[model samples]
Target: MSSAPLSPVALFWRCCLWLILLLALPAQAQFTLGQRATDQAATPHVQARLVVQAPDGIAAGQPLTLGLLLTHQPQWHTYWKNAGDSGLPTELDWDVPPGLEAGEIAWPVPQQIRVGDLLNYGYEGQILLPVPMTVGPDFTPDADGTVRIGLHARWLVCRVECIPEDVQLQVQLPVAQSHGAFAAAFADAQARAPAVSSALTGQFEVAPDGQHVTLQVQGLPAPAQGQELAFYPEAADTFRHAAVLGRDWQQRWDGAVWHATLPLSDMRGATPAALEVVLGLPVAGSSVAEQPPAAAWRIAAPVQGQWQAAQLAEISPALAAALAANQANQTNPTTTAPPASGGSNARSGSWLMALAGGLIGGLLLNLMPCVFPVLAIKLLGFARHGSDMRAQRLGGLAYTLGTVVSFAALGALLLALRAAGEQLGWGFQLQNPMVIVALAVLFTVLGLNLAGVFEFGQMLPSGIASLHLRHPVADAFLSGVLAVAVASPCTAPFMGASLGFAVALPAAQALAIFAALGLGMALPYLLLSWAPGLLRWLPRPGPWMATFRCAMAFPMLATVVWLTWVLGQQTGVDGVAALLALLLALSALIWALTLQGRTRWLLGAVLAALLGWLLPTLAPYLRELPPQEASAASSAPGTALWQPWSPEQQTQLLAEGRPVFVDYTAAWCVTCQFNKRTTLSDPAVLQAFTLRGVQLLRADWTRQDPRITAALEQLGRSGVPVYVLLAPGKAPVVLTELIRPDDVLQALAGI
Candidate 1:
């Protein structure tokens, strides 16, 4: 009894402790070593608050001051805009009345604060940030002769782990005949603010080849010795983990303005939108009030270069050919360097890697749950003929060859379609309702066979079954066909790269890779057959064999179910029903083949063949009921926000300044669904998103959605469950397909 009570208490304390720690964590970053934020309230840290100087409202031409006040509890502090290495700088969002113009933040030069080995520039005790604003020439005063301004401010306050905060503020002040009581204090603060020259400007241009970024700055002072140059992006998403690469300071034609070329290194891509580049100096005789134009500058315009090592070779040969033809069509084209041959290695490497990748991919494909039942059927057949090692070996080899040929045929067909301008990929076949229906019927028939509703040996016209099974070449061909059918849903990890390469590579290389994959898949079964001793472990054929065979039908039935669902998604309920009817008909045809005599079998085969040929042809004309779409929890089913996948959504989200979380997922993908259930669906992560007002956009590829496919291509991913988060004013960070709760939280926080 005592222990039981103690257990609950312990559990409660554990939960409370975890919640406290989680809540205490800095949203923008992890608590790293030697990092600490200043404590204000009895903790020697300061609290940063955002406030504006508007009372009710103000008139045009009224000099307005916006203040970001940092109230230290006592002795603690916070950093300025250029928080050296690992501290937060103050930034704000201001919205004023129409015709009102505002200048940049008048940041006061801050003290150099040292915490461990990191150098941070900030304020301690207490500090106030001021911004000057005024109305346009054509302006009117309100009835109360006042103006109101709204501001959204973000700043990093440190005590241990830098804690970032977002605060909303609105202040109203009357248009006065004289200065208010706090006006002089604000003026004194303004005098201490850094003086950033209005003429100073910086422009960034990345090399076309993407190897370097050159920052061109105008009207900037020469740096003093030992002055460390730094840049803060006005936009947070511009770069990550950036450092100065190279700086070249030269005098521009404009008097006294130096053109400084600062090269950035280890940029890791774009800078975060939250920051602006601030070039700091250790020059003597500069006060906190005199650090503006000479101290910090905003990037006049942001620039990014397109240079991915992997993408250099993805240049379309078709595009190149088109360009060449256009040039040749002209009467006199300017001479240019011969087309570089560097692409040859890229093409060849892609092809060989694709082949090798396909082989490895095939081996992994064997592990998919979707393909397991079909393989089991093949192995069971082998077990039945354990004594005939040669027959087993031949059957296995034949299967491998069959798979290879089928893959080659499929690859050739896909390439042909591509040449004809059909946008497609490896799994594109599954998008056709007729194909889905056909596959469904075929599997159902196989299921019926395994269920033992018919005896093929007795019903056949004596010689046919013997001829079909006995001929090694025919067996091998059939095995190949079966392997291709079973390998569809099982996309191994490397298959994406291989398939993408195959699509872009020469026809012969693509075919070769496809064939290699088939061979790899079939290798295991062939080896098993070669080593007959492995079959000795199987139980002898009896009642149990019948039970096992029947049991195997369920997996096929499951496949049928999945195909039917896919059909519904692609076309509609009508399509699914049609598929179901066709499956029933197929079962009847198989049952007919099991009738006692050869005549019945022949007739059944004829009917089955005709139906098989005709149903697919008829599928196109069938009308389908639209599938039901998923909706957000609060939304009514029909009126929910379930938009089809589109690049437009991404653009719109960014434009609206709303944080977005995109889940690239599909219906037929089991792993994707599993991830959704176990990780994405976690309540803690969902609540965090909901509370933070993060928009959840799902791109469903359940059926082939072209836009979603294009998005996948953009990301260099060929499959579903690709997660991405775009935060307001932050660079988009991609999350792994297999998500973790902590990972989701961190990404959302970062954004």
Candidate 2:
């Protein structure tokens, strides 16, 4: 028997023979769905099929995709959600089991079709429209292993002339398991479908002038400067889409956020509660390696107070007819300015100096490793459009605004939280477990994005773009946010005193100081923009930029490492493991996106299952704070020279007349980690500490510690990486937020 083992060729023939046998007996021997479960219609210009793509059928509680495959003849076309000046969106009438739920049709990006003087939006040749269907968890499969789903689909197929078509389509599937028959169709549909709007918030307001509406947006990826920013409304008569679609509107972008005024049509009709819009950055001839971004958003808005006189509440048909007849008599109200927030406070000279210091401190922070990576990317962004003065100055200003707003918001939050009685400081946000996880994820995504693993802005499937997001200023503002988020861990020289003073002052004063710091941080870029000649020093935009971007990703990756370590410190090894798993899932999804055809969908579903399985079991950890690090920090990490910092340990060391050097640090503190790796741990510096008999101790402040808090308060500081040097009988020497190698040596030598 061993000698008679089947050859590879023989095995292949045997498998083929079995498949042939299986196919031969399939008529009645194999299971099949009811006759009404599938349908197809054909015409000279098109062939439409309503097929249930599930080959293996659906399992209980599982969701599957149903596809409308429309194969149009050459030069024939189909309409999109908005058919522009003509045509209608495809419609499907669902008739499924009582327990099943069907979702709306997912639209692919449509091409702008123009015929003579009229413009239309639609697709040419073949296209697929997929609708999502789900089964209930409590559903029980029929004994026949079959489930029935039906659709009454209708559309107008066009080629010079339009022919309306209607057909009944149905699919019969086994309820035991999911199959792969429509895998390619589903993939194609999803590849072209619009993605859900991200977490950014936007608001639209009716201006006092009956002709205008202002829209403001916040959050989302920043568009490249001078990029095309636009919004396409889904509703036909809501705004003056015809008139205001082009030169009639005025838009100002403070980074990725927007402030836009749209002129209204002669008749606005009744204002709806909300408007659904497609926001995007239009692709340009000079696009980088990445595609432009487009998102679909439902913006909820209310009419501003100034427009009360013009807003209409439609009455009965008879009254509406009368009002419509008199519509010509209506007059447009005068325009008014927007309202302001917070009262005016006169600026004091002393306040100004403190603010200037904050600005300088923030600017200096750019040199810190914590902020360097993101800033590098931002600098590159600025340099890319250095030739355009309008873009350069606007980008710079928007970035400054982003920084100041973030800082002010942080300061406001801190003051509010402090006013509520809980003990908190400048870096208190890091103490929260959720914040830690969020920052880690953000850092990881940014690194991956920079490395070209995926595009941040082009989140939608092909064909979606934000007309408003194209203003490159969004990137500048977002850069400001990134800078502040990362730089929190490190306190630069001159920053500590300024911050300490600011935190102790009134809310307005504190916010002012924070603003000043942001302005200072943003000043260098502003100066470069103001002086266009400096832009000449930058390397021209080309392939090298991509390489440079990839290189910068590593530093961001390094930052993520530190953040992960910080998370471990705050949440323990188990929490770190959970977070890492989430990251792994995210990475898998990212990779899945790069694939095409059926493989992309099949793999995505599997990976999504894995992530879904993991989230419920580990989600609680996001809210779970770590146990105290008091005992954990006591153990020396790789080196015995440093000891855990504590009041008792410090008192004992000082009483023994042993000169002490304390490193007040945190895992999240980038400056602390930077100094530890570069300056403090230098061979000469370690040698100097050893020779001085200085007992070096580390005080970890990753978690909230009353003792550490007291230590910082006593020193008149409110942040970490505060190095203190003490001699047997001398006062403690408070080194600057940032220290030089010589500063350390001199402090040790004198103390």
Candidate 3:
């Protein structure tokens, strides 16, 4: 009774010693079921055990609950029945004696887990899947009056990476009247199971395009009427489980009925007569304190619309092969891991090749039309700084820093968004109408500044203008940033492979490749600034400099026009009109700022008001516009030489043994337009296609389309201007980004 209190340090050590002792004991030793029925199995991340709801013993002709309880380590989880995007559900193979039977497992409501751009439904922490077991009237026990239940259990557990584990376990119980020891555990499991709802009625309709499904459900309880709810289809391949539910797909409640429009999977293989789904909601005022509780209901709704049978059957052969290989890898884990040394060597080689390609592609980007205007401005800056050697060198370094940093930042953002489950790729920014509007305004302002319409310095405060003039390096750096913004839409040769590889690489390696691209683009300018001889070759700053600077404005104006056209393609004529009005108001505002005193204030105020009115008017057009069908704007008027590209059409064409040529292009891509007008429209090329019976298809990427993105990835590309020639039973022949008529003919000839 008089024992002294231990110090904090001593107490901590005592607890640690006890923990070590407990860890050393066998997994099954801790459980005491009084020989009713219990056995345990364990892995590095999970502990599995079998428990029955009969404490004393099983009685003849009585129904009992048997549970396979899985306790996961922190953050690791196991899948549910459907398994969502990627996973296999836990499987149990029971070895029951004669005159004994077990019913299907009663699966509990599952939680949503996101991995990169994929969504999965599973359970974390401890879960009990209860199975109803029945003892027949004729059941006989062993001489010792004990009944043995054998089970082979297999499950996949995942935190960041998945590990498949299995174990064999047997539990022995005496034949006697029994009540469950784990009454509370069994009760909790039963409470979590979804009940079949008799009150709820629903129906689903597939859109005519076969891309979306609209679901309508009525007769919701008062508590869940307007609250957020999640839909989990009981069957797979009904919709794209990986797609972000509320964002990519949409859900809303209108007091009377819950409505949801979800995108269908590209590789959908199901054409069910009715869709079985579970609607889940968070349990309010839940009594279970150990874990979060959810209430769910199961409903089977009849399908009202036709399925896209023809399109569903036309999945590309290459994509089908890839999917098959992926499934094989999941099923056979032995083939997943290669020899460590050989794996490292192969990875290193592949990484180096990607890096090199990024570098070369960046160098080639300088020759693209999109980059020309910015480079022209840099050239003028160089000519102006010809006499100052030190300033020139510093400016060059600053420009290089800006380019590299910009590329790195963009790459990081892209990776982060992807990890958060967004489907995007290179030139993804241009897909947004808002970004297009911003770029159009920027190019317009730059054009005005270069044409000597109004000086930027004059518009700013005197002190700020002085500081900017003192440091011309800032201007050079910004020029480099502008160059990247414009150049991103163009996919130069070699860039496609490198960027595609970068998306699949580790974060550090992908960023290294991005930095390499920036460095390559900056190298020539850095050399020009460093070498005095090269600087001397340029005309000295004089009247000719003014004329050259004015001429550079034409390219900038042309770029604005091109951007306007691109915006038109994405939105419509209304969007183009809004953009033009905004630009006109912005030009007038700048011109007003150059005036003096009261006149400046008056005209500037009117123009500012006009701009304010126009901006809000343009907001509606910024939303996702419905995709327009192929029009004359993309190809020559009234000419059917090129059909809109679709996976189904391509499959059908290839099946007919006809060679198919797919042109993956986008409206914002300068090189794609150039090639379209020249090489693609050439009469000789047209005649060759006609004679050889080559089917031409154009895949427009002017807006975000996941199908097109997936197809481009299959071709080892992440951006547009991807030319692919496919011959039946032959490997797809990929052409260079910039193709000549001869290149097209040669590719066709091979096919």
Q: Estimate candidate 3's alpha-carbon lDDT, on a 0 to 1 scale.
A: 0.73
- The model with the greatest lDDT is 3
Error of 3 at 467 (Å): 2.5
Model 2 agreement with the true structure over 464-534: per-residue lDDT tens digits? 22321343566567667767777765677666656665666788888898788778778787888788887
**Backbone clashes (count) for model 2:** 22
How do the residues 111-179 of candidate 3 rate in per-residue lDDT, one tens digit apiece?
Answer: 888788778888899999888888888788878988888887888788776656666678888878586
Local distance difference test values of all predictions, in order: 0.56, 0.64, 0.73
Backbone atom clashes (below 3 Å) for every candidate = 54, 22, 2
Off by over 4 Å in 1: 1-357, 457-460, 532-536, 540-543, 585-643, 727-750
lDDT score for candidate 2 against the true structure: 0.64
